[model samples]
Target: MLNMRTKAVWGLLALALSAGSVQAAEPEVTDARLSLLPGDSPGAGYFNITNTSDEPLTLVGAESAAFHMTEMHVSTTENDMARMESVEKVDVAPGESFAFAPKGYHLMFMHRAEPLEQGDEVDVLLHFENQPELPVTFTVVAPGSM
Candidate 1:
């Protein structure tokens, strides 16, 4: 049988190894961006993210030079009123995607530079809780459009 001290040492080693494996299991997101929404002072983004590893990923915030502030917001109709709410995190399943589109799931931009117009491109950076600083280019679209 192992001594008490030896058992404790083995337990510590196992814990350290487990932690390392978890840290190495994060997935990577590619080609992600915020889509331009129709209206004023706010917009959203759409992107494709692939979770390559075992660990899950969450998108918590975003940043852009064109806007004063960026947040991950969700749209839901409650009591005949269409309202938007902030999301704490967006979880991406392993080998899956989390898309952000208008009128459903999207990024809300505070105090935009100007009214959004089609064919305009801007730089936006997405922040995930697990993987932060994923920057990409964004394009504006016309109203009553996708």
Candidate 2:
């Protein structure tokens, strides 16, 4: 009851989906998640990075087409005052966890790259000092999200 052309089309689609699933489970990328704020006017981005490999990892830097400049920042507090400072690298030990959040380690987007509507997405690539850059597609979310 099925035509040859139709079966071929279905096979192609299934192959494509399978390839994507394999890439998602690739070894290079371990645990990674990112979230952003709403009404983007100089808003920050949060990333939770987990190294599943046996070696250590150092976050070299980040870049985004959406922003004029992207930098890795670390927050500090002294005498009830808090400030952020740009850093060259962030480290993660084997099987360790690193967090980039408000009032802590985070990424600063100098300018809005794309529309900040919910469900919108941005392609951001993160480079590790010793590892190859990993490109991630992040979905835009409202402020104070997971």
Best by TM-score: 2
Q: Considering every candidate listed, which one attains the maximal lDDT?
A: 2
Per-residue C-alpha lDDT of model 1 across residues 9-98, encoded as one tens digit per residue = 999999999988764454454444445556654666665666776767777777888888888788888899999888887888777876
> Candidate 2 on 4-83: residue-level lDDT in tens?
88999999999999988752221244323345555557656676788877777888788889767888888899999988
* TM agreement with the true structure for every prediction: 0.68, 0.70
lDDT scores in order? 0.70, 0.72
Which parts of model 1 have CA positions greater than 4 angstroms off? 1-40, 114-116
- Candidate 2 contains a number of clashing pairs equal to 1
